[model samples]
Target: MYRVLPGFHQIQQPNGSYFTVPDRYINLFPFKVDKPFVVQAFDRVMERYVVIKKVVLPDSFLDRQPWKRAQRELFCMLYIQDENVVNMYSAFTPAATREEMTEFYIVREHMQGTMQNLSPPTFGEHRTVKSIFFDICRGVQYLHAMNISHRDLKPENILMTRDGDVKLCDFGHSNMEDPNANTPYIVQRYYRAPEIICETMDNNRTSVDIWSLGCILAELLTGRVLLPGRDHVDQFILMVRFLGNADQLFYSVMNERARNFLNTYREFLENCQPPTDIHSHFPDEVFQGGLSGQPEECRMARDLLFRMLVINPDDRIDILMVLSHPYLAEIWDRNMNPDDIPQPQPPEALRNFFRFQNIFAPETLRDEIFNDLREFGERFNIFTGSKN
Candidate 1:
């Protein structure tokens, strides 16, 4: 066993490289007690700063399964290779054998900070805001194209580099778009999509991600959460108030529980006023000084927001469409030309592992993750290209 130190600890990886991390955690969220211990670390081999996420393994099978998320996150990091997405260097257990492992560690590129620390975008920095939003869209688009959905897409999950580039991180809540998986409470409250709120998300998983992007973009423009709902009930009510009552098509897809909830607030629904346009939230003056110094930019931004924040998932704009929108035209041309982007094939082994069987048991997931780690070590390396 590695010696525990008060000041710092050196964690040796399977590949002989090691990371030196401080004893104290760099991040600890009060709301999520089960969150992994995140600390800043120095890579001895790479000679660069890195973030090490330490996940404690539960001793008993009866306990909650944190490894499930860790397994999915590890798979996603390995599968995706994008500049806009955070790069995970490696994942491994400290113990020599899988049965002896007590902790799982994921080593990734160190980011300066999350978007939460940044100041709100002002009118003078409209183009900069657009660029940031463009980066986010590119990340989301790449994930969607790879058949993954980052269910949580709030500012906190968006990390900023020292050079001001934004990259998506925290894949605990991310997964492949499975229509059978109906998780209404997957996303954070403020950025949650209406379809997710109403439990009407049939096969439209990626669109919920687009809704979150819309909320994030709105926050970037105004410096506040677009929909600050106190609770689930209030969140749905806020959506109704902002986008007006759901259409017949929206109601048609909603399950029995959602229908019952709507009936509970039938009186309030009847009394709610007509929904306001996106312009009312972000007026022309907001985009006067920046955004090409034209009012048309405001219209385009609003138009994009309107389409993105659509109440109906079917009517919502896809990631590709969002990338193609006029507001992000310049960034799209410069960085994200369709021909230049490379499409990666999703791992068939992982896909079959998730789809073929009931892998909910902790033991099953643990074994799968062990196999994945072994395969990853053999086939892939950061310094060199894939062996296969």
Candidate 2:
């Protein structure tokens, strides 16, 4: 049984152990709207800490966007299980009935801090950065192989454990890889890909994720955001300035709106020439404390970044290629068997749910979510809703 205390929530397991979660959270930002409230919990059975993410469901029936995003996040987490990905313990609603359910809860393994929040000294060593980046690549590679794209991959979404293990989190913006999927407004502006801004994504939805990874890598090395665009136009202009003008092939693929924008700012873009030396952006002092400052390692890192941050999506390095890159060679296991790799199999129920276009109705979505919860409860031998 699960019950709420005056200032805390308690969840009882069938094994006679319990989990206690306080009402307050460590990462609460009152000014930030729409952010989920995450609180740490103590699991008596495991004798370890966990995180409980509280998601408030919209009251209005007409608003189903948030509900859909939450459902998508849950399904994505269930679909992919990897060492570099955050692990979900369980999920439930405390409300006895669907009508009374105003909030949903997701319990997951505890992480020390996010890449964005951790101090620079934590990543002062170059090998540490490489290892973290390598883990991220592995996670992305697994997702891509499963035909999923993590639309939002930023420092804030990269979680780090106390043991220095890196895991990817926040799948609210994730979706199955579809070339024609028109959601250019997905990733954060700073890490967004050029093709996404141009709205020219086609047959390569994963490329956007790669672009985001490049931005994250740059941030890890320099201790700041690489492309800090104030707005959509600024982001595109900055990208052009760094990578030079878009090629004929790239221009040919651009939509009319993007083309118009380019023509409007053609003069300004021409003045912002590409840098002669990309290495200047990453200084030796940043990696000098560790062996990562070696000339050979620095060259490999720069070369990898160059390939990843290409102006054209078609020219960008794919996730698999990134895993095989020489920079990540130390972590790549040569003796690993192909059969040992875990393949993602999206649930049949989820596939069917997505097939219905008109299922966005609030009532319909609520029912589907409840059904999913019921199924999860059965598999995990946990209580999700009242039997009565």
Among these predictions, the greatest lDDT belongs to 1
Native-to-model Cα distance after best TM-score fit, residue 76 in candidate 2, in Å: 2.2
Q: List the residue pairs that clash in candidate 2.
A: none
Cα lDDT computed for each candidate against the true fold: 0.70, 0.69
Give all TM-scores, in the order shown: 0.81, 0.80
- Candidate 2, residues 1-388: lDDT per residue as tens digits? 4346454555443334344443332332221123426656555545566776766667878777677777777666555567888888776665556676666666678788877766355454567777889888877876676566788898878888666788988887766666556667877899998888887755237888989999988777667688899998899988987878777688777788888878888787767766678777555555434545476777777888888998888898888677667777666644233344445554565455444523577876676666766576567633332111
Model 1 Cα lDDT, one tens digit per residue, 1-388: 5544344456554434444444332332221223326666555555566776766666766743366666777777766677898888876654546786666666678887778776344546567778889888888877677566888898878989756789998777676677777766777899988878888855348888989999988777766687899998899898878777777788788888888878888888767654465667667654434553666767778898888988878888788778777777776555354445545455565565445434578887777677777677566542232221
Name model 2 segments beyond 4 Å from true.
1-36, 61-64, 119-125, 271-292, 333-362, 381-388
Name the regions of candidate 1 deviating beyond 4 angstroms: 1-36, 58-66, 119-123, 201-204, 273-277, 285-294, 334-361, 375-388
Model 1, residue 204: distance off in Å is 6.2
